[model samples]
Target: MPNYIALDWEQDQLFGIEADVNSGAVRLKRAFNLKWPDDVGTDPSARGQWLGTQLQEHRISASQALVTLPREDAVVRHLELPPCPADELSELVRFQAAIKSTRPIDELLLDYLPVEIADDEVAQSVLMTTVAREQSDSIRQTLESAGLTLASIGLTPVAAAELVVRVEEQQRLDETETSLVVWAHGDRVEISVIKRRSLLFTHSTRLTSTEDTSQHIQTILAEVSRSFVALQKLLPDVSIARGWIIAPNEEAETLAARLQERLSISTVSIPEISVRTIDPLNLSGSATVPIDVPGSHAPYVGPAGILMWASGGRAEFVDFLNPRRPAEVKDTRKLRAIVIAASVAVIIGGGLFWRQSEVAALEKAYLDAKSEQSSLEELQERAAGNVENVTAVQEWVDNRVDWLAKSHDLFNDMNGTERYYLTDLRMTLAGGSGAGNITGNGESKTYGEVITLYQDLGEHPERVVNTHEIPRGKDAEYPFRFELDINLQKPEPIEEPARDDAEDTKTETEEE
Candidate 1:
């Protein structure tokens, strides 16, 4: 199962679904919703963090996710061009879209799908889609922060168009037939025209909360009529024979009856949940939302349809964020020929050069080995001779500092005559370890003066490792008598490894 996450941005809520694209079937694993934040305007990271938490809670894991931007965030247009070269048609579409759009071309992310208008292979009709760069970039950055790459940035109406095609396919409708789809979402309604499996026209409008149900119905119908008229003018060759209403069952049935009476066309209400599902009750986040809802199941329809569109079930829409890069898709036929030709060349060249290089390398290595063998004894002698020199250098480097001078510097800063007096002092250096021990006794008139002698020695910790003091009972002047023990850091001894008998014999013979 190839699974993906689909995200939908609506006016009041953010909807997401995890589904598997198993061939033609799109199975919904879980669906989740998060309330749109009030601080979404100032702090954009709030949305990403919220979505990431929701995904974690639902355990929805996918490498990439598809997204549907709100209808108002994007611009969709159906463009028709006069006969021109296939390559130039895209440029023409861009020019037309730029002229009609209020924003500059560079300020928007644009893509298009060429709709097949006729079977004669000369028609140049296209569906041009554009979204504000800021809007697309904002959503893209948010998803990126959540560790999800935006595989496709689509629109609600475009997703609805895909659902319309899938619905027709499941119903086994004619391929050349045309139909009108009216999809009602929360606080918004989208009307689209799909002809021969290609989206022809799409329009979206905000639905106000009104007490009069009839007035609300009239507003939707009027918008539908307007869209229908516009579609006729745009594609005069095609006619929409039937219409489908996608909404809650009761509301859809009522709207369909009214729409049929007003437009004099057959209209039917399609179920809000259109896809074939293995389990309907286990559809919410963590498979917890019941199949039943208070009002209707209209909200789940849009998200499910968007998932179907992303899972290779629909083919008429273009993704702006992750559009197919024609340049990146190499012609495998030409690549295969080149690879084959290169293989033959490599085999021929390798067969000729391999044996020659191998023989030459082997001969060179043999000569180099023989030369190294001849110099081995000399190298060993030189290594043995350097050991004594290395040991001398190490001994001199470690004991270079004179401990007698360092100890002299320690007492030079002390005022023995005024502050304190040393009763007895002796310094001893341990054998070879280069460590010195100093034991001394000092007498002072007061205990404070006795502490001065200890402070003076502590000032030079580099020479005096540590010091201890013991006071003798006071007598007269210089009455406070203190005993001291001080240890001094010393130079480290040099260590040399034991020589083997063979090395000793070589050294002795060299000396001889």
Candidate 2:
């Protein structure tokens, strides 16, 4: 048999149970109040740590679970939606929740179910409800960390109403009429109106004192009156038959009697609805009251109702299941296609780059081969003209050498004759031009002959050198020694034939 567990938290206690759905049987395996330190709420790890200890202490199993939100922080509103297709129901619920809840739509956990379908096909109505997102998330996190899967999250009134309806159905009681079920536990009161096994309205209010009980009853009666008025307005033709009250103890009956006496409505007290009990010891005392009224038995009502709902009893309204959310399967398929397309593009691009590189290398090799062929043809053409160029160069060199030798001979011949005596001689040649120098002996008679010799050599630009010397000294045999250098001109470089021209000449010679 499938097992479902219900978990409920008290300010100082934790209550839980597991139930067999097929047999409508329940077993309460764990119940305890933890003495957590005052700083537990302020410390990040304290709550989880304490909860772990409690779970270990109670030997609670990790399985399917359900939790009820605390009454103080939650606002349970039973709302109606215009007739629409079931597929569009979630959006309608969300829109209604946004309008009714103080919290934004993003901060709410909403659920809905169809209460009654109108005879008209085009338009139908639905019952929708919402709870705080934080409330649902906190319960889910606490149970999931303990290795439990949260099956649902709901309000205490919702759960209690489920159990009440189940008991009513067992008795075969017709629920076509409006009925009020009040369960008063300590300072809190949970009240609900059920019509035809479906919840039409549920509300909770704090009852602080027995003296103020009348005021609280009046307040509840006013709320119930408003709900009936609204339902009548929506279904103006439908009629409310009657009302009933559920209490764990007679306190609810007493309150209901007083309200009936004042309002003149029929009210009855029902027997205590048996639920899975965690601690039979705790169940002792005044906790065993009628199922409709809450005394000390109020804490168990939430868990008991949750188990009843899990055990095949129809839920009056949906809790957390929504079939309208976008489909994850479709999203997965789209993402896979995108990744495949991107991979194919990358592979194709890589192949193109590789082919381009090969083409560039082949083009470079062709250009280099053409350049080398041109160079060979130019060299062949220069070789064909080599004989005439060499002959001209040799002739020029021979003429220059002969001229230089004759100049040297002329100088030696003059020295032998002693027309002028030379003391120092220097010469240098650069850039195909040259100069020389001579120092005259300290004889006034030889001075005129030296000047004449210098003039004659200076006239020949190829061998004549510029001359300079120190001034002549009286009584000195040689006045001064000379130092000089010659500046020479550079010969022009020979030109090579063009590649195209050399190729053409070779082709013509072959033809001849």
Candidate 3:
């Protein structure tokens, strides 16, 4: 099995644990808990180069590592998800995380561990963990420079919880049995609840110090008590059966004794992975890590837990490299909008091109016409003798109404009507209108014969005829009387079709 490094960091410190991981075994080869080297810089390349130098100098050549986002930089929340199928649970958890998180989901890397999967369509509990993308990116850059391939990302509180479980080394706890695990370093403390080898709740609390002061111990105890109280609300049915704290031998025993005395909770302090009795480390190989190192093992707990998980001490761990996101659904609306926009663009582009062509054609034509224009002086000279007559004879003649043609038609109608002869008639033309009116009064020998003549006169297509009733003449000769006003228009000139020259000549010759 390949070896790896479990790494954890703070603002001014970097801790890495080199381990040879096998199936169900994690052999710690080295532990590096040191201050951050000066002026490593913020950018990835500069940081990576510095990290590579440190790794090379230390001779810790494990190429795989699991790193932690500091407790203060990561967030853990207990959430309830709607009942969903197994395949959809991940998608649901990610969507819920996005909604309940304070920061934008896109800015954070999120992962979730299903704590209790409900069987009867009830809301399920999940521990959702998140870290800022910027923080994880920095770690990634640093590790990449060291030629270390990142395996997973562990949050401080979660890694601490898993370490507590792995150190127990017994049958897994059932759902009802939970443990309260605490790890303190400097002024920060991580409190977590672990059940069934998985984390249920985790939180970070800052403290003044745990430097053998009665007041500091009391403060720590109070924080632990509050953690349990919060857990009651978080998981009302679960209770803490045991407590574990990571510290040195003397400090661990002291804190455990204080917990049992003040809070009446049977707590145990895990000093270190004792080399004499509990030897989990395979120190047989020629290793770079000092086997004779001294000091508190508190700092290594987070990184060691990560190594154990990589070595198959499995539990709910967050890997920011593979974060969760909402379900995959096709955006049909956006697709359709793009298609419609493209079609309209094509039409508008074609119209603009066509308009441009027309404008170009019109401009060329205008230039050509300008080149052909006659000089203004020559145009004025041509206009001198060409002045038009204001009252030309043809102007009067064209608009002249042919009253003779109208009279001929009226006379023909009256010629056949001997009984309906006209007693008086007159015709006059309206100036320049090419139309005239005829007014007449006539008596009829027969009453119906006078109307017959009026109807015949009105049958002409181009004229309008109107009749007025006159009192019947007392003369026994003509009993009915009528008056008519006929409005007449210009007569159309007839265009005779040309006769064949040969046919006309033949007819003349035959006649001769």
Candidate 4:
């Protein structure tokens, strides 16, 4: 729902309209044609004041202003180029502008719009427009004095191009066919070539009353034929299949019949003015309409088209005097973005390098720890083997019996007895225990003495136990034989054998 003011400049008067150009629903809020006093151009301030008063009086409220400078003040060029990078294309356009513009490149404000062509084409063309600074300066100054800011400045043909494209889009016309738009304005006819809803070429021709009507029509047709020839040469793939004449219905029908007869192409009468309000404005009333124009109800379609162009129409047009483009601000922002991106890249690189170093140090430390652990495990195994050997030697020493000390004790015990002789002596050592046996024949004065010797030997603390004495009857004069066994430590009591019946009876008789 945004609105814009489109002001058309003529030699003696100014015409304008404020409308909503979005959605192809242009709502005309107000329209006005203000006449300039004869002396108004002499005083610059008087002209600005008059413009401001007219705007206020009509209540034309708009934030953005678009002006169509008189076509005489601008230079237009049609340039073609091969596919190139954007930077190179810009430089090429500047170079071309220097050659094509009458004014020096520095003094001219230049801009261009790409002429839409086929998708598969290798070369692209642009319509370039340039206005001398001095020529636009007065308009800018006047607008500034009137407390207005000029957003865009363009030529009238471009505005007309915008109008044709909008009408085709709203009506849903065939988009692929090449269409010739023959626009009639005042005494001039603007012939434009459109393909895929895009403008490719435009040329202007004027008619005078002195010229024959038929010749004038032929002249217009010849110009169109030449334009078609030029387009076919430039874009060999494209062909003009149809045409639309933007004039009165009668004039359009007559022109259509003549074009079909002469060139064998069908034509439609597409009028310049549209009475259909695509959409209506929120303003109170349509109080002031176009003056002296034939159809009072129909709005001035050209100015409405300009408003549509300003409201971001799809058709391409150059704003040669774009006040919004400030070269210093653009360069500053680009440089700032580059510096920030470089700083971020450097920081990221530094951080990654630092992280890599830390990882390397940690990996080295882990390897060193692994190596030390292996060495400690090997040392532990060797220590365990040494401990086993030491324990085996200790056990061997502890279990060994002192056999020499035991033998000496036995010999010392036997030294105290001389009446007994050791006919045979035997000793055995097993599991750290020792035992000895003795056998001998002893002679005393009587048998009692022998028996007494046996008793005495048995009572010795470290000597004999369980002694047996036997007499060999008249074997020799010393007829007593004895046996004795000795224990190294105190012995458990012996179980005695059972005595026979004869021995028991003999012992009983002796006691009685």
* lDDT tens readout by residue for model 2, 1-512: 66666766555455565554454444444333345456666332456566666666767654777776545555555555566665576677678878877778888777765555233435445556666677666666666666677787766766766766665555566665445566665566666656666665556666556656566566656655654465556555444343445443434555556545533432221222221212111232212222232124445677766666665655574466432342243557778888889888888888888888888888888888889888988887887678678876775664343336644754664555544444544333323332223222323235555565556555544444455653555545544333332232233356886579778899999999
Q: How well is each residue in 289-366 modelled by candidate 4, as lDDT tens digits?
A: 333333221124456556666556657666776521323425677788888888888888888888888898899999
Candidate 2 similarity to native, TM-score: 0.50
- Quote the RMSD, in angstroms, for model 2: 19.2
Better of 2 and 3 by TM-score: 3
Clash number for candidate 2:
16
Best by lDDT: 3
lDDT of 3 by residue, 1-512 (tens): 78888878777777777878787766667777656667765676777787778888878888887887677787777888776777688877778878888889899888887785223427778887888888878778877877888778878777776665555545444444556676766677777777776787777888876465566656777888787677777676664566676654545666766664544422222232111111122112212244644566677766876776676755667777865444666879988999999999998998998999999999999887776675555776676555444345556567666768777877886666568677789987655434777888888898678778778888887677877775788878888888878887666789999889999999999999
Query: Each candidate: what lDDT?
Result: 0.68, 0.55, 0.70, 0.62
Question: How close to the true structure is residue 337 of candidate 1, measured as C-alpha lDDT?
Answer: 88
Q: Candidate 2, after superposition: displacement of residue 431 in Å?
A: 99
Q: Summarize candidate 1's per-residue lDDT along 180-246 as a digit string, tens digits.
A: 7777754578887677777777788888887666777788898887776677677667655567777
Pairs clashing within candidate 1: none
Give the residue spans of candidate 1 off by over 4 A: 40-42, 58-63, 85-88, 98-100, 120-123, 265-295, 324-512
Please give the distance, in angstroms, between residue 163's alpha carbon in candidate 1 and its true position after superposition: 1.8
